[model samples]
Target: MSEPNVLRVEGLRVHYQTPAGPVKAVDGVSFAVRPGERFGLVGESGSGKSTIALSLLRMIKPPGRVEDGSVTLDGVELLELTDEEMRRVRLARISLVAQGAMNSLNPVKRIREQIALGLREHGAAREGRAFDTFLTELLERVGLRRGVGDMFPHELSGGMKQRVCIAMAISLEPQVIVADEPTSALDVVVQWQVIDTLRRVQSELGAAVIQIGHDMGLMAHSVERIGVMYAGKLVESAAVRDLFRAPLHPYTQLLIASLPSLDGKERLQGIAGSPPSLLNPPAGCPFHPRCPFVMDVCRTTMPPPREHRPGHFAACHLYETS
Candidate 1:
């Protein structure tokens, strides 16, 4: 039998109420992340990738609510947990390394103090020398010097600050870590370094990782499986190699084709048109507007997910007839 999934999300729908209408940020999306697995969610900005991350922790703010779906983590239904119960689960079981996390740190607090706060709140460490030693170890695990913890957020480079965030995320040895655009805003060289650090630390702790980002190239290398999201829905999902080798969905194909080749011989192609406005999304398939192979059925009726291969699944009319 297959190992139980560390995290499973089913039919999740997060909508924001506005003067215009309900913005379907995450409309009927579902996927699973196995223990110690690296799952990547890739798409353009406003594709609802980040919204899924926030929903996993039940952190959706006012005007936005999880209208439907179940979020099960380690057999426990996260959507059923109370606010106080979820708070205990946050760092103790699942942690988040948010996008632009470097800037999210308090500028006034020392790095050590910030990290120690979580540990203390969760009762993971005692005060005094025990906490100091634990904090130092956490910093070193993320490839930072132990002494760097004494410095304020402004004192460190962007990359170093990101590392500190990663360290904090792993401090409690959580079963899963949601890293939403952890390497965003950093240079290419620093991006790779941060990715490497994340991979190493996650491996050491045996934690499943959900790496969310717009860069398919980075996701291709960083994750074992990939899920392509378009206009608040998951269009395709498959193993990294399988998805790259034979993408079944038109949107997935376009995304992969848009990436520049290493040899500089193949011309990169860009996807045509912009994503539909979520408030007034296209009637049927959300991607039908920009899809090159869109048919009449696609414009009027939603396509159901079809299994093209053993593990590959795609939601498109083209595969419906297969």
Candidate 2:
């Protein structure tokens, strides 16, 4: 059976106007999310992972327009919607579990009230007992007790806050969930717990999830497909198994090499050079300066995405079938 597309992004380019000039934060990126599938976007800081996530709901702030692209969720184009229309879609259709859950929650509001706010805004019946039952079940599903909902955000621990955030994101049963660094700023155990909750929720709701993180191990463990970004552009994207086995892009190879394994025998070595500044990125391949296998052609021409292997794509000239 053909997989259903839950979200599709095409030629997505987000640029921010700064005093230095226009900074290309997300440059000509394209990817898709299938129903019930987990798609991982892995990259270092300034690689535009968060920017692309924000652009999905048309949340890019002033001077950071989505420039040119189509962000369509289940046939509805988000970029063309008005502010009011977009707001409805933000939580109901596509919700973002922002990077910092501890700070994202309102300190003064009770968890139940905050969750209710999402329910009421999304037109879910607020006066019915069925909704109340569902809310209670949601807290439990996220590993939180019902009584925790009566507590304020500040009263909950970091892990509890993250769980509350997850509950809020899925409370509306959104078709697509953008989890941007959902595990950042937490202890290892908490991170694992949050990831586990997200995994279970995605499976239960049959919703597509776009997990954004810079850590390869976390991304590998949580996602079925991985997209590697460098200097605002997608360098490689493939099935998780295929990517870990044979990464096509040099940048991807470097990222995989840098992952510290649990065996305590593997040494991690990060990529040599730092990512280029977005304000004045390198001329051709943004990763050319850092790529160990840089070719003359890579230094002068931007390589277009090509099918390096069946079902795998990369933007490196060396991997281009053409």
State which candidate has the highest lDDT: 1
Candidate 2 ranges beyond 4 A from true positions:
1-3, 128-131, 264-268
Full-model lDDT for every candidate: 0.92, 0.89
- The TM-score that candidate 2 achieves is 0.96
Q: Please, what are the lDDT tens digits per residue for candidate 2 over residues 183-264?
A: 8999998889999999999899998999999999898789999999998999899999999999989888888888777876
Candidate 1: pairs in clash: none
Cα-lDDT of candidate 1? 0.92
User: Can you write out model 1's per-residue Cα lDDT over 1-322, one digit (the tens) per residue?
Assistant: 4548999999999999999999999999989899999999998888999999999988899799999999999999999998999998998899999999999999999998898787878777657888778877888899999889899999999999999999989989999999999999999999998999999999999999999999988998899999999989999999999999999999999888888888758766999999999999999999998999999999898897768898899999998864
Error of 2 at 83 (Å): 1.8
Candidate 1: stretches off by over 4 Å: 1-3
Q: Which RMSD values do the candidates have, in order?
A: 1.4, 1.8
Every model's TM-score: 0.97, 0.96
Clash totals, every prediction: 0, 0
